[model samples]
Target: MREQPPYLRVADALQQRITSGEWSPGDRLPSRAQLAHEFDVGDNVVRRAQELLITQGALEGRTGSGTYVAEVRPRLTMVRARSREERGGSPFKGDMASLGKHGSWDSRTEAKVPAPADIAARLGIAEGDLCVCTRYEFLADGKPVQLTTSWEPYDLTAGTIVVLPEGGPLAGAGVVDRMASIGITVSRAIEAPEPCHVTDEEAALLGVARGALATTIRRTYFSDDGRAVETADIVIPVALGEIVYEVPINL
Candidate 1:
């Protein structure tokens, strides 16, 4: 039989300690050098072992602090009302309603931005296409909860009243309603969620430690003709909340 590699062997040993209750949740483990000596491996090997545990959700790393046994994931929730049938208003408002909390948002709009490759694909626009970019910081009960940057094709809204997103009369209205006002009826929205680590900028705004886990959502709003009208990247810290999707069963 083939033998396991050094890092895996070291990680296994640490896992044993955690499962045996010797290292309790929220308890910091030995320093990398100490673990290297304990396992008779190099410091790099111990570092890899800790990374493995972190990826498994068995451990967590704080940028300036040491790694610790993972605690129960936070219970914060942001509800996703995927369908119009499930939605009452904007996603922020919907989330507040689900949690029985008050919600507010601050937005800044930037115009004449050229759509990058990924965004162009989602918005079905050409590369370097002019667009309006708006960044939103949402707060629930005076605490920052979610950050999103929305992009709208300039060619689609160049001379329209809602082109600036949060500047028109219907400013702050959602993509669904905003598009509806502009002769385009948004038929549906799709969201794809993935796990990621907090970046320095996000960590500062979301008030979480850098390297902390977070949920990144890529959302697209579609029109009646099935063309994408708007696209956004929404990031929510794992420490602040979780997301619940209201998916229905169709036969």
Candidate 2:
């Protein structure tokens, strides 16, 4: 059998500890030199091991604060819409059923102004449009899992069912679902995924440190007749959650 790379072996050892909860979230990990000595390997090997964990969202390094275990949570799956011909016998179903009950929307207010230029363009709206943004911080297994923000056309969403008791639509049911009830079916959903640094405001709401690694998914929903309806920006802390996508292979 081929020998396993030293760095990978070291990373596996650390990962085992993390998966076993031996090192909890926010717990500092050993320095490179210490890890090197512990594994009887070179410091470079330990550094490589740390890098692996960082990319895997299992660890994070803070400038001057040292490396630490990242909070871990179940990965969230993003399923692309299937074409009509590819739908087969059963149509594609959203996985909201596994996301637990539609919890009460906890109101989180941010005084920040209009949507950024890029976001406004995605929503096909004028720049500097006065918007009321409602945000909800979701939790799973008593840990922060996902942070969601919804931006609506200030005039249209104001004093409507959209701004009901929980503020915004119910959980498990996205903006598209709520809009469809009023004869608006989301025909197109444009999504962009990119790596981002957590801002102070986002960190506070997501319970993560500023500058922490995160995945930002920006989604714009369009009506069946091709009208931009709503736009949402969701940020998932790398450690706390992962975006998973699976594609089947052909025979």
Q: How high is each candidate's TM-score?
A: 0.68, 0.56
Pairing residues by index, what is the TM-score of model 2? 0.56
C-alpha local distance difference test of each model = 0.82, 0.66
- List CA RMSD, all candidates: 7.6, 10.2
Model 1, span 59-109: residue lDDT tens: 766545677887664456766765533363465776676687878888899
Off by over 4 Å in 1: 1-74, 83-89
Give a tens-digit lDDT track for model 2, residues 1-251.
99999999999999999989899998999788888899999999998888777766677655456788976445655344434214322111223324552323345654335867866787677888756576766655444556778676565455666543244444335565566556667676777888998875666555555567888888777887877777778888886665764445769
Q: Model 2's lDDT to the true fold?
A: 0.66
Residue 10 displacement in candidate 1 (angstroms): 33
lDDT of 2 at 196: 91
In terms of TM-score, the best-performing candidate is 1
